[model samples]
Target chain A: MADARRYCTLPSPFPMKRGGALHGARVAYETWGTLNAARDNAILVLTGLSPSAHMMSGAEDPSPGWWEGMAGPGKAIDTDRWFVICVNSLGSDKGSTCPASTNPATGEAYRLDFPELSLEDVANAAHVVVRELGIARLACLVGCSMGGMAALAYMLLHPDTVRAHVSVDTAPQAQPFAIAIRSLQREAIRLDPQWANGGYDIHGDGERYPDMGMSIARKLGVITYRSAMEWNGRFARIRLDAEQREEQPFGFEFQVESYLEGHARRFVRSFDPNSYLYLSRASDWFDIAEYGGGSVMEGLKRIRIERALVIGVSTDILFPLEQQEQIAAGLEAAGANVDFVALDSPQGHDAFLVDIENYSRAIGGFLAKL
Target chain B: MADARRYCTLPSPFPMKRGGALHGARVAYETWGTLNAARDNAILVLTGLSPSAHMMSGAEDPSPGWWEGMAGPGKAIDTDRWFVICVNSLGSDKGSTCPASTNPATGEAYRLDFPELSLEDVANAAHVVVRELGIARLACLVGCSMGGMAALAYMLLHPDTVRAHVSVDTAPQAQPFAIAIRSLQREAIRLDPQWANGGYDIHGDGERYPDMGMSIARKLGVITYRSAMEWNGRFARIRLDAEQREEQPFGFEFQVESYLEGHARRFVRSFDPNSYLYLSRASDWFDIAEYGGGSVMEGLKRIRIERALVIGVSTDILFPLEQQEQIAAGLEAAGANVDFVALDSPQGHDAFLVDIENYSRAIGGFLAKL
Candidate 1:
């Protein structure tokens, strides 16, 4: 029972959908359990905006995964019966060929010259990783948020690669509201004087990264990821220091403020600002209808999956429940067996990550049917 | 018949509700129509976070007001019949005693040295101007957003200052969700290197203001001010340029991004960052319950208005409809004639500013009954 994180390089001159090519592109992935002799018991797990290939515990790296609750030996994903593979997204900085990666042509960091990335490219890169692993098909494909968009793109591009698909808390296309939020995030990073036009030394001297701008962007991201009801119920205007009610010019007083700042501070340390900008733009530019020559239903018709599951959180303002409903409707119209579940969770877009019990039940039940 | 914008300096040593005093403090105001011989037909209108005392077209400065649709002659507020007085909120940069004002003690700009401000202080400052004008009582007090909070404070503090009260798009207390948003806005300004700890020379040459930080904050403010449904309906993932689809490192390619950036750019030129910081904190610290033994009902019991109207928009995520309901319930419990109108508006908290027709009808009808 060996669980190891591994890396594999794709074929030389890997082309991107959005007019770019990587000479030496590599993908990082983690695997659990053993692939059956038929290689039909493999499951691929794709992640949201900020997750690595570590979906669960591994022998080499035993640190907990982002979705550790769902992918253990007898958990929702059931590693005891099925093999699971989690691949880091193509343009992400975490062990992937991203802005932080070295360019083969110049022998320097890609920085701002990493080439344009699209959701389709992330999907194709993951597909190549699966093929390189000698798996002709997967038992199921699970994705969340940006990963959800990538999964759908993969289903459309490589229709026969995956037998089942599960997309949670995502939209077929980026809505104006969601795009506007991401656009501001990019602006925050761009406007920072220290960013140096996205050419700053990310790991060098004084103020190497745009930490202030990225921190504010992450703070705004946290607000959008969670519902107001959840914040109200949890924080409720409680002061961080009840004893020190005297006003200060600039200070973190409210519990919600402290919560957001703490999260943002931690994120600024781990994420690359350039990679964040590229991946966020990829999500915004993703439109399934565009791939199908202008109809989402036609796009769904291209995905030849046996079964599909779409889950949405009721209070998710970022993706909204209506988007999931549309996804389910599109899959149903495509003649695929679709199971749609709407969870009434106040965690909003992050409900898929926060409410583990409910998500595990939904994912477990959906996988049980197969 | 003259509609004139005017200024009045309060007597020396003006005390604040909080422990601070302002010397040579003045309030800028605009008056529409002549006060009746009895002076009982005067209607005092209060503004939101970013508006001045120009409710309608004035003789000296004939620019249309922010609420020009509802405050014109024979309009909802009916300047032809009822004289209207629009006072600039204290601590606002729009011709009020704010961070930009000169300190009588040091003979320099107050900057961050400006004493802490609260909603009660704004209400009290406005009340002094009303009293200085020799008006014993106001026919009505109409407020929107932050102005609504001030109006509630005025009603509680002054009790019999106004005969009728109309609050729109505001809550009696600052909720944790709203506080978190404001806290982030303040943090954005503080983290900017150019801010110089709120001592930036806003009028100095060569990028004196913290434009980038303030712009991002304003952009975030704009998003929260409007509803997601409104943004989706207006600009749903439209490209700014069809030909420039090829990705650039830092570029504005979405229509929503253009809209937000344009708004942010304009806001940076007009708004002072220190003023924004102070006023935003004022809104966050505002809690009507704090004034009345930790009970909002107890606070509302002190307001002795003859009639009250609380208007809320259904899609207003910042100030939800339930807060307005609570306001109405408190007023009803206090034995006042309360009119609670909940509008199904996609404009969110900005419905009071954007959907003028609905607001006009509601406010006009409520005033007509009085």
Candidate 2:
């Protein structure tokens, strides 16, 4: 039951999907449990926009991962029987090559000069990491939200690498409404004077980042990530305490406003503004149809997986249930065995992160079948 | 038949619901058709957050209002037979006593010093305008969105000002979800460096009006105002042309992004940022329960109107269908004849504006019975 965080370096001049190359490219990952002699009981877990490689807590880390409840011993993922590998997304700021990383060519941070990222690039990087770990094929690949897009890309790029796939709360391509929301987020970062046209040296100069813009962007993101029904049921126009309201300069009166602002503040501390811009834009540009000559069915057919399970939250306004239905329909049309599960959860796109029992039942059932 | 925009001056020292009187308060209004001899055929119209008093085309102003199709001759409110009056809500920037207007006391713009506005204040101001016009309301009161909130307030305050009420796409009070969105909107403007803490003058320095923040706020607003179903159906994943994308500094690729940006730009130019802050806050503070000392049912009991029509759009995430249902149920419990119509529209909160024929049919049918 060894658990450790590790890194895998790609060969120099790694090719990217959007006609660019990266030098000294590496991916940081964390693994739990021992690899069996056959190396066949491995599972790869991809993350949403802002997670680190720390997918679950272990004896070494003692700190919870984003999917704290679903990936432990005897949990839905069952690290006891399965070796779990979680990779930090390539364009993220968490111990991976990103806008915050130094450029091999310039000897300085890449900043905006970082090569344009595509979901395919993130998937390819993860695949290279998997091969570096001496695993030939995974038993399953599990992804949620943006991670779902990356998992799909991985299946498309390296067909037959995994026996099963689970994509939760995601779409084949970013819908127009989602894209519009992301565009505004990018604009919020770009408009901030503190961003300085994406050249702010947050680490070196100890200068403040675009805190206001990024916080606002994150607030907007929180609104979209959760369901209105959830907020109404949870907050319900309750006023904040006078002391708390007094501390806020903007007269934050409502409890819901306080909740949004608190989350935004925490996000601004953890996330790099440039990394957010690149990853958000990358998700917007990702279209599965582009890989299959303008047909999602054709693209899905390229994946060599035997079985797929897709889960969608009914209240998810960001990636609605219809999007998951599309994924299931496309996979079924492509001659793959697909199980699509729609859960009625008030948590919206965040149900995968919050509704542990529902997701555990679905994922555990699918894994048991595998 | 004459249609012209007009104005009415309220007697000095107009008192507001939240306290603090406004001196030399005035209201701008527009009228369609001649008043009947008995003054019993006058229908008063209230506007949403951003509309002017001009609710329809007129002799002097041929340009159409927000409800152009529904208020003309032989239409919903039938200007041919009923004298229709639309008042610019108090605190609006369109020819009304808004933050941009001169303060009689200080001889400068009221700005944030403008008395705290409530839906009741807006309703009261409109009532004063109606009385100054020598009209004893008889026909009905029609309001949509914020206007609907104001109409409800008017019915509660005056109680017998109108015989029938038509509230479209609005709730009795702003829900927690709506308030959270609006709080973010206000924070966007407040955080902008250009806003100068609500002191930016459009007429004087002209350069420091928080244009970027307001634009972004308006863009977020437009997204909530419409439905995801409508955006998906209309825009899908269509990319903007190279020429159009070139115009955006943030690399706007989707047509929906361009659409939101365009609408936001227009709104930033036409709307006063402070007015948005005030009116949005007012809506959040509006609670029918507060009027009746903590019971919405008791509040509804105060309205003397015998009949009412309440319409809700199924896709309206802002003013959800359940809120309108509550409005109808409350009115019915209070012994009033109420017709509740839930429309399956993809336009969301803006359905009352875009789905003109459906709204017209409902309102016309109700008016005809009256």
Quality class of the docking in candidate 2, CAPRI style: medium
lDDT by residue (tens digit), candidate 2, A1-370: 4546788897789888888888998889999988899999999998999999999999888788899999889999999999999999998988889988999999998888888899899999999988988998999999889999999999888877989998889989998888988998999889888888887765734665788889889998999899889987899879998887845335799899889989997888688889899999989988898878988767776777888899999999889899899899888887779999999989888999999999999999899899
lDDT comparing candidate 1 with the true structure: 0.87
Clashing pairs in 1: none
What DockQ class does candidate 1 belong to? medium
lDDT of 1 by residue, B175-222 (tens): 988998898888888878888887787563457678777888888899
Candidate 2, superposed: residue stretches over 4 Å from native: A1-3, A247-250, B1-3, B247-249
Best by DockQ: 1
Local accuracy of candidate 1 as per-residue lDDT tens digits, A12-51: 7989888979998998898898898998888898899889
Cα lDDT tens digits, model 2, B1-370, are 4546677787778898889988888889998898988998889988999999988897878887888988888898888888888999999988888888899888999888898888899999999988887877657888889999999899888866788889899998888889988898988999899888887865633787798889888998999999989988899889988887755345788899889988987788688888888998999988898877887777776777889999999999889999899889888887789999999988989988899989889999999998
Compared with the true structure, all predictions reach lDDT values of 0.87, 0.87
TM-score of each: 0.96, 0.97
